[model samples]
Target: MAIKFTPIPTTTAESWRNGGTDAHGQKPERRISDGRAPCRHCLKNVPEGDAVLLGAYKPFDAAGAFTETGPIFICEKPCKRFQGGTNEVPPVIAQRDQFLIRGYSADEKIDYRTGQIAKVSDLVSQAEKIFALEDVSFIHVRSAAYSCFTTRIDRAR
Candidate 1:
């Protein structure tokens, strides 16, 4: 029943850093972090006054109705990707009091029944319950307030 909390792939982040366009097909906006912005690649909050790349990111490979593109932040400079204990929530995500959790099927369709807003402490347990369902293939952790993409969670093999 192990679960892996994953950051955005480094290759993708590097692409963005190397002048790649966002989901909107436009250059990513560079901004100064307000400390609340978390880098999706590093799974850590970008400190206040530091540079960040704000852009639209589509987390799925498929292009369909179920596929969603949303705003995300990443460090303007390179940072180490997150490597942490399986089944533990990333600190950047846990820093928030609550988050939206949803499950997606193997075909990349949303499983409406698996969506909920969970307290940080309850996140792991809730994700476990979602993973219990046969239809659920992966989970997305999102900001409860802004509904921005935070990180992804996958059932460990």
Candidate 2:
């Protein structure tokens, strides 16, 4: 199976940049990047000294007990959304040490059996394995240390 690393939609990111409220109904907090945080839309590190928008984002469209809302960083300036071949891991995320990988069903509910803390080196293979499961419709990569949202993965067409 070919899996693609998917970033949040550009429209959603644009909304935030245009003074939209976050998931908690609050404005996105602007902060200076330390060069370690990746903008969820571009899947690249927000450069040091660049302004970042910190806010809560729910990666799913569904509202349910298993749906999670978590923190994410977005570049305050315009950035092209990440575009890569199927099964290619974004460079910024690939440089990370580890991340929490979990599969979600079609309904957007977490499938606990697919949860694991995976090394960056194993992300592609691990995601492929999870995609092999029948119930898994997608996967979400999150910071293992902070539990913040990173990126979403889906079986490529």
Candidate 3:
């Protein structure tokens, strides 16, 4: 199956910034009322009655100095799909508040140190430096506040 990424909504971003946590612990998965749907990563509300599931995921990998993968509920429903093409990163990502874009090498080590981007246009140039790494498979765009995975870029097929 092809890899796909969905944009996180703005409202969810606000909630996470304000302070929220998954009340339920690991193992015993929890389900919330459809009316209260929220994206585990961005902490934004999923539209009323949207289907959501609580599952574990590692935003980072296991056994690393910064391995940060964890449980998150992605939209079980289709919203918008993003594929890295045309060398353009979406405006939503470029304009996000307090974001850090980092490129990882094939060994998953952070390539050029991550930097803060004030606008979306900066991503293309910033990404160019890391894109050349031989083992780089993906780029992680994340929120600095929670260090949450906002989106990932993969080789376009």
What TM-score against the true fold does each predicted structure earn?
0.97, 0.97, 0.54
TM-score of 2: 0.97
| Cα-based lDDT for every prediction | 0.92, 0.92, 0.51
Alpha-carbon RMSD, each predicted model: 0.8, 0.8, 8.3
Regions more than 4 Å wrong, model 1: none
Model 3 lDDT tens row, 27-73: 32345436544454333555566655554445544468655664455
Clash count, candidate 2? 0
Of 2 and 3, the candidate ahead on TM-score is 2
Alpha carbon lDDT of residue 153, candidate 3?
A: 57
Clashes found in each candidate (C-alpha, N, C closer than 3 A): 0, 0, 8
lDDT of 2 at 83: 95
Q: Which 10-residue span in candidate 1 carries the lowest summed lDDT? A: 87-96
Off by over 4 Å in 2: none
